[model samples]
Target: MKTAIKICGISTLEALDAAIEARADFIGLVFFPPSPRHVDGHAASALAMRAADRIGRVGLFVDADDALIAEGIKAGRLEALQLHGEETPARVAQVKERFQLPVWKAVSVATSEDVTRAESYRDAADLILFDAKTPKDAALPGGMGLSFDWSLLDGWKGRPGWGLAGGLRVDNVAEAIVRTAAPLVDTSSGVESAPGVKDAGLISQFCRVARAA
Candidate 1:
């Protein structure tokens, strides 16, 4: 099967189109206010409607409250939620059980030891995204455009599907795939022109590379 593609942090029409044209399997709309990629709930809902089943509508959030998560779900007919904050395993289970939507947990990886926790998440999450660990003082947890040691995933063979994210781009994505053999990959900052600004050309290039790989 072909590797799935997820283009995240979509905040514009052109960016949305680029992901669609690039044949992305999913498009992510961030709802966390601290992140530069944050989008209004209503806007995200509108965009997801426009997308209209062309791809999975992903709602990205931090350690948001139940009200916030509910709002996000109602905002868009989201197929999945990416918990990008410091959500515990119990919290993950609660969100999954409450929403009955498949949950994708984003785990920060800055070293090899981080890989071991992947399985614990696998039990609660339907999918696990390996992202770079952000600075402790960072305002937000993710979308930092950082890259961790991909070698940590060098021989990672675990249960549940996984995605490679953080600093993924047109140039390095193929190399990432070769190294991790990730069945799916997600990108946010990598395809952007600036903070919260997605570039269509980069989106197209990224999808092409992921598909080709």
Candidate 2:
């Protein structure tokens, strides 16, 4: 199977085009205001409309309220909602039912214990996204562009429907796949010219390399 690639924190038409042109499986939009990549609901919705149907559109949010989720739905043709915050399983169910959309819960993985967290949402979420654990005082929950130990995934067999996220770049994504054997990888900062600024060339390269891998 081909490895899935997600170009996240997308805020511009150019970046969205790059993701679409590269045939990325998922194109993520940051809805949290604190994020440099944050996009207004209208703007996000506009960008989503321009993407090719082959690329999935994802809305990224922390432990946000229903209003935020409501606005997100209005903002785009979202295929999935990525809960990147401390949301409870109940909340996941609520969001899924209310929006009638698939849900992907992002679990922070640092130790073996963190991996077990996915089981909690097994019934509630459509998929799981393993992201790096943020420090206590971290500004935003994700998009820090940091990587955790890939070896931690050496024997992972917990979920077939999860995505590997955190600090992935074109150069290392192939190795990450070889090590973790992850069928899906998500990246934001790693493919950017700067924070929240995606480079079209890198987007193309990442998709090509991951597809070939």
Q: How does each model score on TM-score?
A: 0.96, 0.95
Residue 159, candidate 1: alpha-carbon lDDT: 65
lDDT of 1 by residue, 5-40 (tens): 999988777788888988999999999887788889
Clashing pairs in 2: 45-75
Q: What is the lDDT for 93 in model 1?
A: 94
CA lDDT for candidate 1: 0.88
lDDT of every predicted structure (CA atoms): 0.88, 0.86
Writing each residue's lDDT as its tens digit, candidate 2 over 1-213 gives 778889999999988888888989888988899899999977887797787475788999889998888888777778889999999999999999999999999988888778876778888998888888888899988889888887776656756387899888899999988878787899999889888888999999999998888
| Pairs in steric clash, model 1 | none
User: What RMSD, rounded to one decimal, does every model reach?
Assistant: 1.1, 1.4
Off by over 4 Å in 2: 52-54
How well does candidate 1 match the true structure in TM-score terms?
0.96
Name model 1 segments beyond 4 Å from true. none
